[model samples]
Target: MDHATPRVKATLSDEGQRLFDLFRRPQGRSRPRPGERAAMEGARWGRLTVGDTAVVTYRWGDGARPVLLVHGWESRASRYAKVVTRLLELGYSPLAFDAPGHGESAGDSTTLIEYRDAIVQLHEAHGPFEAVVAHSFGVTASFLALRDGVRARRVVAISSVPDFGYVVDAFCARTGLTPRLRDELRHRIERNLYPGEADLWTRFSVLTGAADPRPPLLLVHDEDDEVVGPEQARRIAAAYGERARTLTTRRFGHRRILGSPPLVAAVGDFVSTGAVSGGLPGAEAAR
Candidate 1:
């Protein structure tokens, strides 16, 4: 009887579409191919341990107050070359690292907890930081790291999310894991696969401690971002309110948001001063 009856699966079908949307990044037809190769050749690359895991590091610029850029998931630090160059031009030393499992770093899967820990290690290694900039998952990890104990003058969350639950839900959506199976899978991933403890989301509440952290934050996201959505930035802005500053752009989308000049200027100004000074408040386009 059950086999003969057509079951309603619109819920699952919707889930599939959501998954597709979540993974749909911006179409960057003209990204930095030449710049990437040049940066790779021009900059000195090396490895360092952020605790047990080895992270790949890129060095550029020269100043006392270091500006660190942590890349998003599945991306190496080298990809943020444009931002690094801008930071250098702003007169601050720049350091970026490939988090574990990405770029020249060691490991397989990554978790927010591990990412935060890596940032902590990196901060300790080469900081007394003037500022830290991060994108996507790196943004979440940055929040948690700051809340832990890192002391930076300011933060720039490029395409950041405030909630860890959303991050988990995003993963489950992509993997098509039911609540029960998702729980089971999360348990397994945390226990054996990940470099950190189980239940990272729960740990976030305590780890990312802030009753409004002191440093001014610059949050950048795109309205058309199909990956993490602009709502994530809204949530963080709401949490910090005036303490939080934001820039939204059209067409920049997930990754290419870096390519926008206004975005670069915003970051540069933020590094120069705690505020997102110069040009305009919001919306940037790539050239």
Candidate 2:
């Protein structure tokens, strides 16, 4: 438990209101650091509205093969700057956006359903993508979208979160939430956020969300990823069998994997492998 857990436990009320509030909102938004800013340069900027929230969107190239870039929780789209550059070199158009409640988006809190909606809308507006490149929580949101009918030829998941329950469990474990409070939080999630969807935890999972005969997947995870364990990738690959591939690395941890040159090159190469070259036919429509 961190310093706040004992105090929170002592002050807990009947409703477990404080715990619910903390669960609902991310601690903070991620911004581009000085060294990361250059990767964000020269992109067309636009806004996408997800339920009254204005999500910030960016497009990096006009290559015919559109590849969607999805960043993890507490991360901004610009964090994929290096990957974006690599995609551009391979003649693949890269599109990305800040999800509701994160980065430049207009919200302080968001849910998986909201993230799925944003992604599906983007695909409807600009896609039929060649592939999807997602990191951490983005893997979950993207998988949910794919299950909900957003189509992509291939998927690259970096530091993947295997399921929704894992997220809750990890959070509770990290914060040292009491067992009673954790149960209450789970009940509140089901009752408030997803009424009538009793199987949401399973349905929203990256492992099970993409049903059988699923799209080809590339699972990348660092052995030392403290945030999301490396074993998550092994489980996904095992489930998908031959449809999925793995790239295991060391020392990169959760976030640094996005910036690794060799890894980004491999991802770009994987995404562009048989993708045809040229400007996207409906490129102008996205405007």
Candidate 3:
């Protein structure tokens, strides 16, 4: 049952429904602060036009091996600062881009399709990435890109949502939208945001057959993650069978997992050597 069902049932109205839609749309985008901007000033920066949006990209190191860093929703490329540094130390170049509607990109709203387009555009421009390291919602977009033929030797998904339905469920729970209103919202999203695609959710899901021929995947999730539960990671690992490995952390939670030294090392090791060793004590290996 949705936690917000009671509140939504009590306050159901046309205006409330509209507000819920607006709330579901991506917002609260963060820009690089002075320190972050200064830190990234030395990196090569540019923009690529995808459809009607301009995505800002950053490049660090000049190594032949290129790694793509995909940040989550409401986040920018700079969020991968520590990971980029580690990758550079491992003799691999790191490239990252701000998705449209976030960071330096131009747009107020974006969808998974846009995210996939941006990834494809980046691949076309600087690709055949050695590996793609994606976090949170970016993992879904990265998986979709891989499914649609973007080439990457390996992938690291941290704090990932296993399916698109989880996002829908979370939105409904947060907004206290009743099942009826939730259905209406889904219909409106299909009609307005994704008119041409009838099965957007299924198409976007990482666990679905859409993401076939999975790359060597390193699935990392914090046991204490409040945003995306650890079960999502386990489910994804199970879905990928022998092609994936799972790592669980204790105190890292959701966002903090990104900055964990051991996590960073594990990702770097996986990308560079196709193996990860000496992780946190309780880290579980799946297949």
- In candidate 3, stretches whose alpha carbon ends up further than 4 angstroms from where it belongs are 1-13, 33-39, 281-286
Q: Determine the backbone clash count of candidate 1.
A: 0
Candidates sorted by lDDT, best first: 2, 3, 1
Task: Summarize candidate 1's per-residue lDDT along 114-140 as a digit string, tens digits.
Answer: 678777876877877899888887887
Per-residue lDDT for 9 in model 2?
62
TM-score of each predicted structure versus truth: 0.79, 0.88, 0.89
Record all residue pairs in model 1 with backbone atoms less than 3 Å apart, i.e. clashing.
none
Error of 1 at 258 (Å): 2.0
Clashing residue pairs, backbone N/CA/C < 3 A, model 3: none
Model 1 score (lDDT): 0.70
Please report, as a residue range, the 10-residue window in candidate 1 with the lowest summed lDDT.
23-32
Estimate, for each residue in 1-287, the C-alpha lDDT of model 3 and write its tens digit: 68798776666656556854684557688867564564478679888887788888888888478899998878888877778878888999898888888888888877788888888987887789999999998999898888888999999999997766788788789778767888877777777777898688888788877246767999988899999989898888888888888777888888867768768778888999988884356565445
C-alpha local distance difference test of each model:
0.70, 0.82, 0.82
